[model samples]
Target: MKTAISIPDDLFVTAENTAKKLGIPRSQLFAKALEEFIQNHSKEKITEKLNEVYSNDTTKKDNSLSDVSVAILRNSLKNESW
Candidate 1:
């Protein structure tokens, strides 16, 4: 895919140099950066959805159940040779 975009001159030079140093074309560098940007934005969207769901939940946690789980975890860890 071919696309045109504008960026600062210093950044452009830096990207060009970095791409040359890494032996990859400037287009690949931009593509990789754009791909990372999309991935990061997708993660942000997922986090936002999770936060929304948690905020709307009304479940109360049982202290005894949590304590038992923690105790079991501690017991399991104690027997491990580290």
Candidate 2:
């Protein structure tokens, strides 16, 4: 697949240099980077969805530890006389 990408000149220079150092064409370097980026972000999206589901399920029950907020902890500390 042929696509046009508008990359910043500095970044392009660095990428080109890296490709040269690795003895690979600049196109291959870009393809590998795109593949890795897609895989990583896909996993991140799945993890985010799982976290959302876990949070929703826990909300229906008494899960004090997971539900505690930073504000609540700060207020508790402030109210303490010691």
Candidate 3:
């Protein structure tokens, strides 16, 4: 596919230099960059959807242990030399 797009001169120069240094054509460099950008954003979209689904659960649960258990655990930890 052949297409044209405009970018800042500095970016264009940098891409050109990178392509030369990597021994690839400018089109290949642009295509690779676009492909990588799309793949990354696709993963981000999945994460966003997972976050949206999980965000709807507003329920909170008490996960803390009883005071006696906490005191025993703390005493055991204190006896161990760090």
State the C-alpha lDDT per candidate: 0.92, 0.89, 0.90
Runs in model 1 deviating more than 4 A are 60-82
Ranking by TM-score: 1, 3, 2
Which ranking of candidates, highest lDDT first?
1, 3, 2
For residues 1-82, write the lDDT of model 1, one tens digit per residue: 8888999999999999999999999999999998999999999999999999888745445667788899999998997988
Candidate 2's displacement at residue 27, Å, is 0.2
State residue 50's C-alpha deviation in candidate 3, in Å: 0.6
Better of 2 and 3 by TM-score: 3
* Worst-scoring 10-residue span by lDDT in model 2: 58-67
List ranges where model 3 is wrong by over 4 Å.
58-82
Model 1 TM-score relative to the real fold: 0.68
Tens-digit lDDT track of model 2 for 1-80: 89998989999999999999999999999999999999999999999999998778655455565456656787789968
Summarize candidate 3's per-residue lDDT along 1-82 as a digit string, tens digits. 9999999999999999999999999999999999999999999999999999888744432223465678889998997988
Evaluated against the true structure, the overall lDDT of model 2 is 0.89
